[model samples]
Target: MAPSTRRAYATGERSFTCYCQSMNRSPWPASSDLVEDYVTHLFNTGIASSTLSVYLSAIARYHVMHNWPDPTQSARLKAILEGARRMNGVHQDQRLPITPDLLRQLHSRLHLTSNQHIDQRMFGAAFTLAHHFLLRVSEYTSISPARFNPDATLCLDDVHYDRTMLRCTIKQSKTDQRRNGVTLTMQRAESPFVHDVCTGYSEIRRLLYPANFPFFMHASGRFLTRSDVTEALKKCLPDSCDRMRYSSHSFRIGGATAAAADGQPVDAICKKGRWKSASFQRYIRPFPNT
Candidate 1:
């Protein structure tokens, strides 16, 4: 299994084990009836249907790996899962997109001071890069404190810039299970705000880091994590409500939504976002109050 898949399954299995322990039930060779009951319990806890499905998958994988009968495969359990979906609803809580107007506002409002100039510049560059490249947080920042594989992480050398274009190579991605990488290029936007921020960031980063260091870094010289990026973004947002609705994922969703609003074709958006399927439609939210 891929590292990402393994991590997800590990999380699901841990959740299952905790549930079994709380209920005084054995999870290793769980019965169909017990599995169904657990599914219902999880639904009652307000987990989305998609999350419940992942939990079930984890349970199935565990049973297969342990050479036990997979209770989740029972027809009765399947019906119970289907019923859980109907009862709980499948709609996911999506993050609000950060549109171009919002991006410009953040850029203008987040001013630099002598005391923290480097930090502000880093955040500005990181934010602009994420929006321009339609990047997931994990694509540009590390999630773990431990050392990451070069094949799965973005290093400083992955970025290349020319007179009019900025190109970034993603070493690996969730969609690229084969470990084959992809390159994304961003030309100077007509507004120049994003381009200017990115260029300033690159110049600052060159002074602070070695060639092979991770591209996104904190003031302390550590690689920026997802939480770090999110907190920085919150500081840039104008209000508490916008801060609450936005997250690292807002960059990708916002870019896709903005492109759609500009009348860009679906295929073009998918290509730029590196999505292999029509699932990109899910990211194109209607503008607020429209």
Candidate 2:
């Protein structure tokens, strides 16, 4: 199983165990009626239907792993969940993509100075690389100790420069369970100003770290964390309510949206983003009129 799947199952098991303990019920060999009651309890607590489904899956997986009958497989339990979904609705909030205009604004604000030169250059390169490559924050930065997979992480050696193009090899990812890696290449931006900024950042990165070092680093010499990247990107944007909607995911969403606006085919965008399924459509938002 993938590390992420294991983590989700662990979380779901914990939640179900707590629920069973509170009601003085046995989690193991739970009856369909008990599962229905648990589902109803979760629904009443206002958890989204999607989340409730995960919880149910976890319960089912737990039973299957132990060679026990899964109460979640009952038609009655499915009906309860279906009812909850219809009652609560299933819309999820979509994070706003950081468009090219927003990226330009961010790039312009990262001015290099004597005191903050290192930070400014690092942030600029990280931001530019993320946007151009359509990276998930976790793909580039260490997010949590428990979830970090060294095999999937990017190190300095993974990056190669060939003339004006930068090729980055991602050894593993959420989708790559077998550890077969993928290489994503981005050419120098056509705009001279953008090209210069990207080139400058690469130079700074090379000067500061050895070839084997983590590609993204903090000032203290540790790998950059997801929170660090999020906080830094947030500071680059203007202070506004919309800023709150932008996160590490905004880079991926923005890149897809920008590419679509530029007339790139969906298949090309999927190949660039390493999306295995049509789910990439979720990232392509309609470009707003300026």
TM-score of 2: 0.70
Across residues 10-92, which tens digit of lDDT does each residue of candidate 2 receive? 88889888999999998887889988898888888999877777777787777766778878878888788778868987675
Candidates' TM-scores?
0.72, 0.70
Which digits, one per residue and each the tens of the lDDT, describe model 1 over residues 72-186? 8789887887787677666865688888878776776556311467777777777788887788777878655445456656777898876687778988765554457888776
* Winning model by lDDT: 1
Clashing pairs in 1: none
The candidate 1 region of ten consecutive residues with least summed lDDT is 107-116
Off by more than 4 A, model 1? 1-6, 11-47, 52-88, 112-114, 144-149, 189-191
Show model 2 residue runs off by greater than 4 Å.
Answer: 1-6, 12-47, 52-87, 111-115, 143-149, 189-196, 287-290
